[model samples]
Target: MGIPRTPVRGVAALAALAALSLTVTACASEKATGGGGEASAPSAVGGDGVKTGPGVTADKITIGLMTDLTGPYASFGKSLTQAQQLYFEQANAAGGVCGRQLEALVRDHGYDAQKAVAAYTEIAPKVVALAHVVGSPMVNALKQRIETDQMLTLPQAWATGLLGSRAIQVTGTTYDIDMINGVDFLTREKGLKSGDRIGHLYFEGDYGESALNGSKYASEKLGLTLVEQKIKATDQDMSAQVAAFKAEGVKAVLVSVGPRQTASLVGVSLAKGMDVPFVGSNSAYSPQLLPTPAGPALLKDFYYMTAGTPISSELPALKKLAADYTAKYPDTAIDSGVPAGYSAAAIVVDALKKACEGKDLTRAAVVAAHRGQSAWGEEFGTIMDFTTFDRPASLLSYVAKPDKAALGGAVVFEEATTSDLAREYRVPVG
Candidate 1:
C-alpha cells in the first residue's frame, strides 16, 4: 500500500484517461516493505491467524488505477490520476489511512479495451482493488474477471450495468439520469417545445448508451422528436451525424459524447450553416474544447449537464478543493474530473476507515463496509442511500454552459435537477 518516493511512470497497462503525460510521487510509508521499518504495518495475519487479501500486508494496502493518458481521453485520465495521487498524498500527510499508507499502481490503456484488460490482469494480482479505471468499454470487457475475483472497484464508467456489481461503489449520479435531467432542463428552461426536434449523438459504449437511455426516456416522456446517431470512440469527425441532424431539421442537439467529437460536431454543424444549440452529458466537455479551432463554434452552441457539482461551482467545499488543487498542481486548472477523482478517493478512504475500525482491513471487510452504508455523500451535490444497488446512490445533476473564461472552460450553473422518472427505471447488474 505504501512506497517511499516511488515514481510510477508509464508501465504499459492503461493510458491516462485524458492527459498526455503523467507524473506521480508516492507517499512515504513505514511499512512499505515490512522489514522492521520505523513505521509498523498491520500484520498480514490477523490475531486469528488467517491470511488476508491480495495487496494487503501488516502495514499497507495497494490499489490499482487504469488510465487513458496516451489516448483520446488522456486528459481526463491524467487529471483523474493526478487528483487521486493528491488525495492519497494528503491522506498520508494526515498520518496515513488507519495507520496504513495507500499505494496506487497505475497503468495506461490509451482508451483501448484490450490494453485495459491487460492492465487489469497485470495489476489485479498486486492490488486489493481498482481505486479507479478509464472507460466503460474496458470495464465491460473485464466484468467477468472483476466479478470472479470479487475485487472492489470505484469505476470510471457511470453505466447502469455497474449497479449490480457487489464489488463496485458509486455515489454520484449515473449518465442515464444525468442525460434525462439534461433533457428535462432543456424542455423546462431552454425554451424547447414538447414536440420540437432534438437530435442525438453518442458513442457505442456503456457511457454513451447510458446517456442515450436518459435522453430517450426524456424525449418519450416530454414528447420531443428524437433523431439518433451512434459514433465510435476512435471517431474524430462528426460531419455525417451533423448532416443527418441538419437534414432532420432538428432544433437542437443532445450529445452523449466527449470533447473531441463535441468540437467536430460544433465545427461541422456551424460550417454546414446549422447552428442549433448542443447540450452534452457530463463527460462531454473537455478543457481542450475551448482552445481548439472549433472553440468559438462550441461556445456558440455547447452546454453541459454534470452528474456531480460542476468543478466550477461556488459551493464552499468545492471552491476550497478547487482552489487547493490548483494551488498544488499550479499548471493545471480545476476541471470536472479533478473533483470527481478526489471524491472517488474520498469514498475509498471512508470505507477503509470503517474496515479498519477493528484493525481487520481485509478486502471483504472493505467491500462489505462500502455496501452497508446507510447514507453516503461525498458532501458534494450528490448524495446516496446504499440501502440497495438497484440504482446509483443518487441521480442529481447540474446544468452548465461552456464558457472560455471559466477556470476549466466550463462556466455557469443554473440549479441542479433530478428526474422522478429515472428512479423508476430498472438498473441491471451484469
Candidate 2:
C-alpha cells in the first residue's frame, strides 16, 4: 500500500498553527511561583538562615528523576539514570550543597503519559527540582502542573515547543536547531544539492513536529523538496516509510524517532536497495544498536546530531567522566547518555549552588538562579547561556557516527558547530 502524502505546504501550515497554539498556552498560563502556592512555604530554616521549601530540608535536598526505565527508550533512560545517580553520589561525597546531602528520587514512567502525570503529581511535592525528565511528550503532559508547582526541571528531550516555561529548561540545542545543522551538513559535505528531494521520518508529536519545522525551513531556504512520513512512537518498523521514500526518489532521509525505528529504517532501506544517507535526531540512535543485525548498515550511512559531547570525546572532562563512570558502573556499557546525564546534573547543581549562595533554596529561587545563568559548561560540550527562557541554551550540535570500537559505540565526526542557517533560524518558542 502506498503511504498517504500531505502536501508540504499543508504540513508546514499545520505545524505553524500548532506552534501558535502552544505559544499561547505557554505565554498565557499563570506565572509560576516559588512553589505551588502553599507548597512554596518554607519547610525548614537552616542555621545559616537559608529559607527552604518543598524537597528542601535542614540536612538534605531531594531532586526527582522521571525517566522511562522499562519503555521503548529503556536503554537511553537506564544509562541516563545511572549517570545521574553517579553524579549525585559524587556530589554527596563532596559534602553536597547548602550544607545538605543531595538525594535523587527516581520514578519510572515507562514512557506512558498517564503514568508520567501520576508520577509527577506524586513526586512534585517532594522535589525542589527535577534533575531530568526523559521524554518530550511526557514533559508536555506535565508542563502545566510543573508550572503550577513552580518546580525547576531539566528535560532530556529538546523539542523547541517545550520552551516558554520558566520551570522547564532544555539543556542543549533544541531539535529544530539540530535538524537545521544536520541539513547544512548534508548540503555541504554529503553532496545533497538544491532541488534534491529529501525524506523525513518523524514521530507525530512535539519531538518530530519540531524537527519537521527545521526541515521545512531548510527545504524552502535551500530550494529542496521535503517528503515527510509521520509515525507514532509505538511504531517500530520503518519498512513502509522506507518504501515510501524510495518511491519518492528521495536523496537522503532524516529521522526524528527512536533507536529501534532508526535501526529498522536503515536496515530496511539497505535491504530494499534504497541506499541513502540517514541523519537522525539525538534520541534516534543508541549505542546498544551497534551489536544488532542492523549495525553494519547504520555504520555505513547513519549519523546523529546531539547537543552534548559524545562519550568518546578526548576532552579532559569527558575522559574523566568516562573513567569515573566505568569505575562506578563497572559492567554497564558507557553511551552518550553518560555525558548527557552528567551535564544535566551539573546544570542543576550549578543552579542549586547559586540558590544556596543567595540563602534562598526555595523552588522559585532555584528557577531564578537558573534563569540568571548567562554562560555555563564549556567542559561539557558547547557553552550554553540559560539567561533566556524563550530559546534553547545553545545552538551548536555535534554530528556523530556509529563505531563499534568506541566506548559509546559512536564517535564525533564533527565537533560542535552552528551552521549559518541554524544560527539564522528563529526557533518557535511555543
lDDT of each: 0.70, 0.81
Query: What are the models' TM-scores?
Result: 0.86, 0.89
| Clash pairs, model 2 backbone | none
| lDDT of candidate 1 over 196-284, digit per residue (tens) | 89998988867777778888888888899899999886677788998899999998898777666776788888889997888887767
The TM-score of candidate 1 is 0.86
Q: Which RMSD does model 2 reach against the true structure?
A: 9.4
How many clashes would you count in candidate 1? 29
Give the number of the best model, judged by lDDT.
Answer: 2
